[model samples]
Target: MMEKIWQRKTDETIGKPILEVFPELLDQKYPELLNDVLSKGITIRENESIAYIQQKEKLEKFYLDYQYTPLFEKNGTVNGIMITVYDVTNKVEARKKVEVAEQRTRLAIEIAEIATWDLDFLTDNIIYSENLPQIFGQEKGSVITRQKIKRQIHKDDLPVLKKAFGLALQTGIYKYECRIIKPDAEVCWIRVHGKLFFDENKNITKMLGTVLDITDEKNSHQTLMKSEEKFRLLADSMPQHIWTSDPLGNLNYFNKSVYKYTGLFIDDLKEQGWIQIVHPDDQKENINSWMEAVKTGNDFLFEHRFRRYDGEYRWQLSLAIAQKDEYGNIQMWVGTSTDIQDQKNFTDKLEREVSERTAQLELKNRDLINMNIELQSFAYISSHDLQEPLRKIQTFASRLSDLDEQNISAKAKTYLGRIEVSAKRMQTLIQDLLTYSRTNSAERVFVKANLDEIAEEVHSDFYERIEEKKLLSIFTL
Candidate 1:
């Protein structure tokens, strides 16, 4: 072994002096140690002692377990030094590598705020990492035991912890999350994962586990729960029927108003779906519209009749919109159904009334048209038949007046004049009446009329009456 380690031939080292064979030992502690052993007549030994030697003109390092013993003769004197050596370089280097790796693992555990523990049930003792005390909010160097650790656990979680241990004994696996109270009275959450070890007798002998602090995660979860509760309360307070569904469009939640309006329990709605409350005639269209919105992740809108709690079907305007996450992924759907039954009834009544009124107005319009036709016929008769007789009377009266004065008496002539005046007035009045009727029936054409001409016509028609009454005339121009 020495020859192999020194990398020299046995012939070169076998009978040589120690200093001559290993000249490199002159500057090392081996020479001094050998001399001390010889002088003291004693034996000395070292294990895994480091040495540097020159081999083939190169310096190389080695670890060795070596011994130096003084050789004794019968005179009670040491005559020479005996040396023994064994190489241990490989074992020492491997051990050093293992130590380095263990150090790295410990550092990683510390950085991650994890604590490792080993519980020996046989001894009822615990061996834990250096940071365990700090995790429990105890002072450094505090002795940790199973009982102490259990004491730190929240009282409410003791039963759960016990159950987990019992299960771990049966199943060889242990996992639990529970709250722990620090020495300073601050509460924190912890998650424990462990594996159980048993003896040949099937009795638990040890447990190995890691503990991690989860207080922040617990607080965040609690905040989210509170926010969801608030949302539920707000939804329930609203008058409209509010509901929510998962991303897959499965209805999961309905507010108080929905229960009040439909008179159905949550489980009933969940099992049968809220669509069961829709009027049968509207169910198909409602399902179609809702499914289309879900498949496309679009807003939903539909007007349908819903069966109310009292068994009356009322019109509802239902609307839904998708709620999306920051990544634009649909998270859920929120929906509302508003009662528009009164408005719908009012609109239907108005439309009916409008139809009835329109029909009545059309009938009245037809009656007025017939009446206008009768007036036109009357005007035609007045213009023709009435004027022809008046013309005859005036012509006969003129003929009479033209006859000799001796043939006609004064009283008869006066009656003839009055008859002629009356006939002329009747003719003029008939003409005016016909003109007024024509103006009403025909599209009016505006034309300039001489006021003086109209006045002269009127004067000629009433000349005999005006002469008989001797009425005064006034005109402003």
Candidate 2:
């Protein structure tokens, strides 16, 4: 079968040496493999070799994988080599492309400063990327062992790393953030993400992960926490009520003043507890306004009455402003409630005093008005009654004067003239008094009056009486 398969032309061609039949095996590339199989009497051998060989019509280059085994004679001594060939050109090309990809990936990892690691569970060997030294701040070519990496980890973080790794053994996932002391003795934080590989029996076979530097992120968080603590301390030190709420207007923090004024513990004032401290009359309006402000992220200011610890409702001015992020999203509402009870009390007192004084002035005005009306009525009645009596006296005196003076004694006639003159003077005095009363009693057009003109009128009436007196004087002498 072997002779037929090789198509040997004669028995001598079948028993000849391998190189005598296939001379292409004489290349230097396959020298070691040829020695191991043909000269060393090896039991079995394998190798990959390339060669140029004559084909049906042309010479071609071929990549071949060969398996060589020694054939034994009847006496058990090695006789010749038996060979098997397989073409592996495509496999070789694929392997070269894989190597190129790996090179590119390694370059990318270095540029990104990522520290990649693979740990073989069975051998307890950890293979780290070339960039591991840079991440750990270690010198170039420094030895990196599992124990050395463990030593670099902070004492407080070692147990955390171990626990996360242990959990990965069971869960096939791992994540951890820990601090490590760098080669320069400076501490830095790192975050690690890992995936665990399992074998058929559910045993851990390997772990693959990457580490990232996170020192900047860690420091920023610490600073923010410290700033918040300081703000809380300052707010608690104030006497006025201070509070904070989320964007939804749900209260989250209240200062010490809030508890002191309301006489309520923090636990007691969790949800809507602030409403209880507000006076019942003001709660609805206050809550509505606050909700509107929160929905719109606008500032709010209002005054309402709040119940104090002593069960007294006092006026307070409540103001709140929304805290916002750079994107204009509301983060929280910071607010203060200041006492305005004293100012409100003062304003009430002032208003009461003004109202009382206004009432007193109105009462005095009405009394003065009533007195003027009564005085006007009395003046009218007195002027009417006195005019009738004066007319009767003048008429009777005239009639007496008309009685013939021839029939009267001279002394009697003189007395009658004097009586008439006195009656007329009394009438003039009454008219003057009436004019003065009318001036105060009613509205009148006031013209410029000369006192001398008024005196001259009265003097003329008395002058006529004086002439009559002169006549009487003549009779009496």
Candidate 3:
């Protein structure tokens, strides 16, 4: 090819190598390719050289190997230079795309915290994802084999896992939720979801799966279940009357206290039979409300009186509610009923005591009223009797005081005046005493009043006494 190109007519083709024809090629289009040109340019097309310049000036480039190559020639240069064109863009771009995809896959594996595995069931060969090292607690390229994978699973769960995995392979369905053991002897739960594909022969050709660490979620669920069971047992063992009912108001369960209180066996109060023991006054309303809750799928909470073992009625505060399904349908109702019998007993005792105290108070009040009436009559009679004597003494004394010297001596007149003055003072004192004592044991009546207004009235009544005593009194709230 090189000899043919060199022997061509000068007018038909320029034998100058591509670099000789375009001496500034390295400095022209892609200067970064200078190293590439010096190291690798000649190896691409060493048989060819710049053969012709198409432009009138030396700036034009023409193809010598084919029309794709561009060649140029300088005006004064004796020896021509050759420049070679090599196409490497397509391969480089393809390699870059592959590198990007690999990097993205690696980044995804790191973020998910998940490890993947591939198995060729036909060859019994196993390949692991890049993240396998973190999950296995081993470095990359650790010894991985079929036996190693099987040994990592929990011993007790091996059979169960194998059955599920086999079923998936046979059915082309994904098997999931297998627990495994880590090398650290830690019990780790893993949710393995894998799909198996089969060839035309119905033999599994490939199996791919993802491995996740589910130890925390599983442990949390078990802990919650255990806590719930503990609470249920504790509540069921209590002595307080306990009972649970369905959303339709049907009694489903009851503790020993309920049986003891009602004298009814477990079988006696099934369905709606318990309503027969409710107080007649509240039974209809209670049953209606419970039925409404069931119809509406709302929570039921009510309290009513029920018949006791002694043939007497007892008040019970029963609470129940509907436990609903995801679609808001009432599935069941569960609640506890506490005896409240002690509360009823205490309340009855208090009511009886209050009634007895009220009766005693009425009797005492009647007695106090009667005594006050009698005392008021007695005071009126006594004050009238005393007033008549004082009036007579004052009249006689005043008469004697107005007498002449012959009838009454000056000393006698002075004594009479003194006696008349003293009699009037005594009468005034008796009247005031009667008024004060009259209010002491009168009829007792109670009414609510504004305390501040009452205090103001009392203060006015004592104003004179306070002024007479010259006392300064300070009152505050």
* lDDT for each residue of candidate 2 in 147-175, tens digit (9 for 90 to 100): 78888899999899889988887788899
List, residue by residue over 1-477, the lDDT tens digit for candidate 3.
Answer: 223223335654455554654455645543333334444433233223333433434443333332122223364322322454433435655776999999997788678777888888878888877667556566677867777778888778888887887788667766667677777876777777778888898877898877777778899999999995776687667866666666566767766777787888867877448777788999889989888877886766777887888888877787767778899877677766655778988999999999999999999999999988888888888888899999999998887777787987877876676677678877987897677666644544556999877677556546658769988854443
> Between which residue pairs do clashes occur in model 2?
none
lDDT of 1: 0.89
Model 1: what TM-score?
0.62
- Give, for candidate 1, the lowest lDDT window spanning 10 residues: 468-477
lDDT of 1 by residue, 1-477 (tens): 645687878898788887998888888998788779878998999899999887888888999999888999999899988778988999999999999999998888888889999999889999998888888898988999988888899999999998998888778999999999998899999999999988899988899999999899899999999999999999999999898899988888889998998888978887888889998999998899999999999999999998878999999998999999999899999999999999999999999999999999999999999999998998888688989888999999999988898999998898888788778888888888788887753666789999988787667666767769987643322
Cα lDDT listed for each candidate: 0.89, 0.81, 0.70
Per-prediction TM-score, please? 0.62, 0.52, 0.47
Higher-TM-score candidate of 1 and 3: 1
Order the candidates by lDDT, highest first — what do you get? 1, 2, 3
